[model samples]
Target: MVTSVLAGFAASAVLIVAIGAQNAFVLRQGLRREHVLAVVAICAVSDLVLILAGIGGLGAVVSARPGAVTAIRWIGAAFLVSYAIMAARRAARPSTLNPAERTPTTLGATLITCLALTYLNPHVYLDTVLLLGSIAQQHPHRWLFGIGAAAASLVWFAALGAGAHKLGPLLARPAAWRVLDGVIALVMLGVAVNLATG
Candidate 1:
């Protein structure tokens, strides 16, 4: 059981500690010092829900529905493209990148974006549902695996959101924000393309 849990933790951490839209958004929110707790909570809770669903055998149901997957893929791709455009626009106007100078988004709007980032990414489903679920089933203590995965998400989001402000000093310049948004734009578009193609 311990081994299963550890394996699940390792697998989840590996998959999550990658450069992605969700991570980028969370980091930005953290650095900006805007609703960091809310963002972290949403992400961790969302992951918990998905991990539970996967371990509870919803993964099989999801995998069996090719139509559902296709629909989600299309929706995800569309969302990614829109976000990429927004990021590109942000990059174009480096002046708005300053966290202190920019108007803070409403809580509702921030929550919506957080939810969208958590749900609209096909890769999230692929990793949490298909991959994690399949692997957990291989273990005798599947629920334990889910617990470990959920714990990983909590730790990761907490650290990312709470610790992001430490880098605020470095990203104080418009140039830094410009580069960050530019990279985000490129990554989002690339992910969008992959989703559409797959």
Candidate 2:
């Protein structure tokens, strides 16, 4: 059981530690000190839902429905492109970081964007659902593996959101925001292209 849990944790961390849209958003929220808890909750919860669904055998259902996945791919690619454009704009025009200007997005907007980022990414389904679910099924304690994966998601998002604040001093400058946004834009765009082609 312990070995299963450890394997799950390692697999989950490997999949999630990459710099993706969700991670980038969480880090930005942590840096801006804007609705960090809400952002973390949405991401962690979304992940938990997917992980549980995968373990519960939804991965098989998803695999059976290739059309659904294809539809999601196209739609997700479009969404990623739009986000890339937005990030590029932000990078081009570094926003002033006055207290009032810090949270340019309302809580509702931020939450929606967070959800979209989490759900619309095909990699999330492939990794958390198909990959993890398939791997969990190999273990005697599949449920324990799922639990461990979920715990890893919670810990990762919490650390990312909370630890980002520690870099607040560095992010105090507009130049830093521009650089960060530029990187985010490139990542989003590259992923979008990958989705569109694949």
Segments in model 1 whose C-alpha atoms lie over 4 Å from true places: none
- lDDT tens digits, residue span 1-198, model 2: 998898888889999999888898898888788889999999888888898899999999999999999999888899999999998998898567633256467899999999999898898999999999999999999888988898899999999999998987777788888888899899999888988899
* Candidate 2 lDDT (Cα, 0 to 1): 0.88
Q: Residue-pair clashes per candidate, as listed?
A: 0, 0
Tell me, by lDDT, which candidate is best: 1
Question: Lowest-lDDT window of 10 residues in candidate 1?
Answer: 92-101
TM-score of each: 0.96, 0.95
Error of 1 at 134 (Å): 0.8
Best by TM-score: 1
